[model samples]
Target: MELITEGIKKAFILIFTGDREIFEIMLLTIRVSGISVIISMILGIPAGLIAGLNNFKGKKFVISIINTGMGLPPVAAGLFVSLILWRSGPLGFLNIIYTPAAMIIAQILIASPIIAGVTLAAVQQINPKLKYQAMSLGANRWQVLWILIREAKLPTLAAIMAGFGGVISEVGAVMMVGGNIKGQTRVLTTATVQMVRMGNFDIAIALVIILLFLTFAVNLVLTLIQQKENITWAQRFWR
Candidate 1:
């Protein structure tokens, strides 16, 4: 009761007072998650488009792998990334362990599959006839692909939101790879965990509040874009 109230108060203080450390954590969280989602979109959208629209051998196997990746555990991703970034590991030459770069890498791994899976589903749901119609009209492969992508833009936005949400809220993998160093790789989620472990429930709750607010803000913008697109699409359909 008191704890909750105190935490709420602290959250407002931190937000309104513009606490430097809190702001840094918030920015880092956004920067890491933002970059991760963008990279994931670049990688995932193409992979999903290719997998969904094309026919080839072992397509089912490829899709199965993507589906599996969508549900991959954060801890497992962390372990895998940690192994590769560890001093004795294969990619140790880069020496990015415990850095923001490492956190971004882990987040990308966590987010890309989710975006890809959702995108794959979205593209698959499109009417196949559209592709044939475009092709018959002399549209080249690239043009056809563009048209299909435009058609799926709304759902693709949803995929981006999902990817952003996944990585923004993630803790385990980032914590593992980033080592939660203060003023460096510390992010909202990892910082919250640190506060909790230190029995600073008020601070932890404040961090949680900030995180929820951040998530809501980003998703709200995305949702607005999505709904606007929906209305535009409906108008076009009616006309």
Candidate 2:
């Protein structure tokens, strides 16, 4: 209890003092996770929409694969990315290992599937009649897709939140690929782990607190957007 209290106090001190190391780690964590989630959104949203809206042979198999990926282990993702980025490995020429880019790639692998899976479910829940109605109105394929996406925007925001949550809290994959190099690739999760291993419990707790604050702040913004959208949608329905 005393340790936790002390840690909480230390966290405030670190934040108020504008500790450079902590600030840098927090920023890197946000940058890596933020970029990963954005890329995942660009890739995952379309893939999910295509998979959900289309009727093709082996579609179930593809969805099953996505579902499997949604639950992929972080360490496994780390290992796979590391292998590809390893010297003498297939894509080793790019030489991104042990860098923030490598961490972002690993996080994208972890986050993309989750976002895709959630988006798939969201789009699939839309009424089939809505698509038909839009088609009857002479809406082109792209127009219909846009309409459906708008209808699913609320849940898509949820998918974004989930993706952000996944990548922000991730440690194993980032650690493996980034080597947790200070002033470069270090992030809150990895730093927390490092502090813990070094028996710096107060610092570790501080890192965890900062991580939680980041998570909460991001999610709070997402949730506000979602609820505002929901309210607007409800108003439209009532009209």
Candidate 3:
């Protein structure tokens, strides 16, 4: 109880004091995680949409791969990313190891599959007759796809939420690839781990709170977007 109280006090102090280090870590965390989520969605959405809409001989194999990746262990992802970015590794010429770029890469690997799998489920859940109807209305292939995607906006928003949540809370892969360099690649999740290992429980608690608050803030915005119509309708009724 005393520890919790002290931790809360420290958290408020760090936040109210506008501590520079904490501010930097928080901003970096958002930047890396947000970039990762965007890359994942860019790559995952089309792949998932194609997979869900088409039937092919190796479709199951592709879906199995996506499902496996969704459950991929963060440490394992870290190791895989590390190997690829190692000094003598195949892609080492780019020289991104131990950098924020490396951390973003690892996070992309962690998040892409989850976004892909969830997007597949969302697209698959839509009624097939909608596709037929769109075609019957003289919609071209691209138009049909756009319509279906718009129809699945709600579940797609859920997919965004899941992907964002996954990478924002991740630590292992970022720590491995980023080397947790202060003022460079260190982030909230990794900072919390470091503070705990060094026996600074108050700082750790503060970092954790910041992390939670960040996650909640991002999700809150997404949630508002997701439920905007419902909220508007409720307001009209109460008016």
Which digits, one per residue and each the tens of the lDDT, describe model 1 over residues 1-239?
99888877887887789889888998999899999999999999888988998899999999999999999999999999999999899999899999999999999998999999999999999998899998998889988987888889889889999999899999999999999999999999999999989988867877888899889999999888777744554356474
Per-residue accuracy of model 3 over 109-193 as CA lDDT, tens digit each: 9889988899899999999789889899988998887777777777777888898999999999999999999999999999989
Q: What TM-score does candidate 2 reach?
A: 0.93
For model 2, residues 21-51, the per-residue Cα lDDT tens digits are 8989988998999999999999888888889
Candidate 3 yields a Cα-based lDDT of 0.88
Q: Give me the runs in candidate 2 sitting further than 4 Å from their true place.
A: 230-239
TM-score of each: 0.93, 0.93, 0.92
Better of 2 and 3 by TM-score: 2
Summing lDDT over every window of 10 consecutive residues in candidate 3, give the lowest-scoring window: 230-239
RMSD to the true structure for each prediction, in A, is 3.1, 3.1, 4.4
